[model samples]
Target: MTIPKSVFVVDLNYVVTLPEIDAHIPGHVEFLDQCYEAGLFLASGAKIPRTGGVIIASAPSRESLEAHLAQDPFHINGVAEYKITEFQAKKHKPNFFD
Candidate 1:
């Protein structure tokens, strides 16, 4: 079988105040939901100190992923900056992507 595409570990660092970030949570969640439904996002959550968040995701290409991320409310509002790391999955549980 063909190998899957690279997975992305997205690190979001808040660029604005907590209150500003909080204001965009709802829209951000909506964006996350859409990504999950589209099978682009595998997992996501806030950081321990609430400074930002992290998301595990995959897409056909890095460009595709970046395009999707551009729609996030955080991005739109300039509330957070993203740092993306890509890796090939050499090992994983059976059907982990399923």
Candidate 2:
């Protein structure tokens, strides 16, 4: 059986500019792909209302989680920023993984 994990929630405000547009989107996509390959960011996408980004990631600790996110190109290129917040979620169903 798999052990329970800590799922972190990341909220990105937004970036409005040509440099940010060119750097942020592609960078985020590349980072997301890497996360998928690494098995850390289970799921990630843009937020509702088109504000910014939302990522659901699993890590050992908040610092580790931030480090993982820091690898994202958007962050490295100074085109984007993130607010990492811890979350406590409850789920119950016949098929939780479904």
Candidate 3:
């Protein structure tokens, strides 16, 4: 069997008005683009009812992930709070990590 890899599920909850969150979307997306380019993020999208967002990511350690997330515009602006959960991916698509 292969060893499982650590993955993080980041849940973002809006703490401010929708307009406030919207104002940061461009910067937030730019951040996401950078993460994706760095192969740190797997997937991300906004939640239904437009509450907040979620991101699936992988990193060497939780500390590293936290550091990266700290750069997010929402985090910087205090418009959203993040709750991150880490889990081991014991089973996933054949090329999920490729």
lDDT of each: 0.93, 0.71, 0.92
Ten-residue region with minimum lDDT total, candidate 1:
1-10
**Deviation in Å, model 3, residue 55 alpha carbon:** 0.3
Let me know the TM-score candidate 2 reaches against the reference structure. 0.76
Tens digits of per-residue lDDT, candidate 2, 2-98, equal: 4335667888767666555565676678779987787777667776776677887767788888888778777776666688877654553443322
Candidate with the larger TM-score of 2 and 3: 3
For residues 20-68, write the lDDT of model 1, one tens digit per residue: 8999999999999999999999999999999999999978988999999
Candidates 1 and 3 compared by lDDT, better number = 1
Residue-pair clashes, model 2: 0
Error of 1 at 88 (Å): 0.7
Model 2 alpha-carbon drift over 4 Å, by segment: 1-3, 92-98
Best by TM-score: 1
Q: After superposition, how far is residue 60 of candidate 1 from its true place, in Å?
A: 0.6
C-alpha TM-score for every candidate = 0.95, 0.76, 0.94
Residue pairs in collision within model 1: none
True lDDT of residue 34, candidate 2: 84
